[model samples]
Target: MKDVDRGALAISAALAGVAGYVDAIGFLDTGGLFVSFMSGNSTQAAVEVFGPGAAVALASAGIIAAFVFGVAVGGVAATLLARPRAWIVGGATVAVALVAVLAFGGETTLWRVALLAAGMGALNTLFLADGRARVAITYSTGTLVSLGLALAAAATGGSRRAWRRPLLLWSSLVGGAVVGAVAHRGGSPFALSLAAVVLAIATVILAVRPSTPERRPAAER
Candidate 1:
């Protein structure tokens, strides 16, 4: 693969892992709701809305709304920024760090959840190119499905490279969740801080002068 492709894939997988980490932290904090995984939250929201958990339903709706708002903000920022990849990722790192600080203050309520949602939402913009994402880093439902399909294809003699990226993305998420879950046992701050540190490292890696361009291939040269 080309240097640029490698960089994109690397950063994409890293952010996916970060998303999973933060999502796991959010799940633990919220007593079983997702920050990055909207589908899961949506389902829970429905269950709560119809069940006896009216308060929980309201919180779920708020989280969903906050996540959508964050996605919109991230998309606009990526469109307006001069260097979307670096700025978006870097901004997300900062956002997650703020969540860590807030968590340290014993504030793991809606505010922290909003920040986590925004951070992961911004992360999704990192791989956007020509209005299409090269990889989906914030969610893994499609990634898992694609991995399964690729496995079936490989069983029929397909190339291994065709499945490697999806597998890496999937595994990274699971690994991150494990780390986040373990860290959450210490405290919410610890979990958020861990995610922030990884995202910060990812930001630096993307900011460095890479041997090849890390932006979209079709970007102006």
Candidate 2:
């Protein structure tokens, strides 16, 4: 593959779609959020865990922190894992995705936070560990902001591929969010069911690709 495969880009967009919708529904229907974007959550969580945070901010932070811890767990899990092993990892990832929704499906509780966080972190970790970070499913707001800036710069005469891809990413995320919102508001079960299907397919595809062997983390090396 060249520096970046178009095929990979295509796949990333699809996954981003899923992430966008899944998270939208999570927030709209469940009264909480966690589609996969943790970076923002992490920052928000940090603000909360320390000081100068709101109630929702603290909760969001906790959710993000738990999700990150879950990511660490997924990373540890990845250590013993391989490519086709991606299916197994992906399955576990989906498990958490569902848990995130179901936990908030009804009542709002503290454990609900843990449930969503673990799932978000796990799912996000699987994608990253598999060398699929190009597929920015979670935290798409940044993607949108970046894409807009890129498009603006491109219109003004930028020549880099950077602008185009991010714009495309923002579009995909919007499309996904729409699909998710419609499906969820009409029937969360159906929406979730559809998401589950997409996730299963995406996971299997990733599994078929050879696992991108990673450089050992500083701790590992």
Query: Which candidate achieves the best lDDT against the true structure?
Result: 1
Per-residue alpha-carbon lDDT of model 2 for 1-221, expressed as tens digits? 11345755666677667767766766675365453666655666566665665776766766666766766776666556655335434754466456546744665464554654565456545444344443344557667777777667768888555677777767777789888888876666566667767777777777676544323354532
Worst 10 residues of 1 by lDDT: 212-221
Error of 1 at 141 (Å): 0.4
Badly placed stretches (over 4 Å) of model 1 are 1-4, 210-214, 217-221
For candidate 1, the C-alpha RMSD (Å) to the true structure equals: 2.7
lDDT tens digits, residue span 1-221, model 1? 11227657887777888888888889988888888888888888888897899778888888888777777777787678766667778888898898888777775688679777877877776655677555778778878877888888789998656778888988888888888898889998877877888888877787774624545456442
TM-score for predicted model 2 compared with the true structure: 0.68
Instruction: Return model 2's CA RMSD, one decimal.
Output: 5.4
Candidate 2 ranges with C-alpha deviation above 4 Å: 32-58, 84-89, 96-116, 126-135, 141-160, 210-221
